[model samples]
Target: MPRTALFVEIPGVLIAAWAPDLLLPNVGIALRRLRQRNVPVIAVTDHPPVEADEFPDFTERLQRAILEVGGELAGVYAALPDKPASWRKPRPGMLLAAARELEIDLPTSWLVGTDNADAHAAAQAGLAGVVLVEGVDPPTEELGIVVATARDLCDAPRVMIPRQGGCWHDHPQR
Candidate 1:
């Protein structure tokens, strides 16, 4: 049987801001709970090649930063801008790669992101559902379907069922 995994986004989802307190409290709770459940949470991000501040090594560093905040990650993956659409957010490429390399079942996985791009990517990848952190209200017409919504990162774990998968909430609200 193929195992289910949790695919998480970095910037907005994990570290909401770049400051001394980068990780949100609920975000840490979500990561720690998922870790306790033995769910493989792989952090994914896009590498803006033109950005002198961002690089290939940022993913690993982001993972370490998350760990310091009580979020233990299984691994981290990145998609370069120069790569195919599948490699970037709003597309399933990066998620697909992580699923393939990690041996995860797309139809049984979950994604915790802050925008519809994350939701779209999960839907495109055929993931069971998604937990979109509240605050950013992207156009619904532009999004596929937001399986679930979290007021903050902390609500993610409550919405996702690691073993049997999770339920779907078509209507997303703050």
Candidate 2:
């Protein structure tokens, strides 16, 4: 079973989940909420591309996993190429490419992941911002930005706000 962490919604005020696996507990309500709001939803990841047949099986499995957990599947964006500069985390290239291909405005989009790389990518790609999930931390002193968890992001203030707060090392909690 997968674990879910809720994240902030974009322009449509929807809800999203971030998990290593697709199935999650208590995600049904959130998925239904997003559906009720008619928001565009998707899953973003750094997985490399697979062959056509394999990709379908993977997508089907993912969809089934979501449904099995009582969650809805708006869509998923995977199959990123293996080039670091083009598809790696912290680059924003793969995400930007996906946004363009999907016709989603980068500014109104949210990137949910479990690392500073994803956060940096969101910042670089003009996303509303990133919702950093639990269990990953990059040195805050080195990286100027630090996001806590998915739930923290959902309740974050509206509008694009810069991180002018204390550095990661400055906080005792970190």
Clashes of each: 1, 1
- lDDT (Cα, tens digit) per residue for candidate 1, span 1-174: 457778877766776545423665577777777777667888777733224335545555666777876668777776764667678777888888888787877776788887777778888898877887756664466334346776776777566653343343211211
Quick one: best TM-score, which candidate? 1
Q: Which residue runs of candidate 1 sit more than 4 Å off their true CA positions?
A: 47-57, 138-146, 161-174
- What TM value does model 2 have? 0.60
Candidate 2 lDDT, 39-98, residue by residue in tens: 445655564234445656766766676565445555665533434555566677766666
Question: Where does candidate 2 stray beyond 4 Å?
Answer: 1-22, 48-53, 67-71, 79-85, 138-148, 151-174
What's model 2's lDDT at 173?
Answer: 19
Candidate 2 lDDT score at position 22: 35
The 10-residue segment with the lowest total lDDT in model 1: 165-174
My TM-score estimates for the predictions, one after another, are 0.76, 0.60
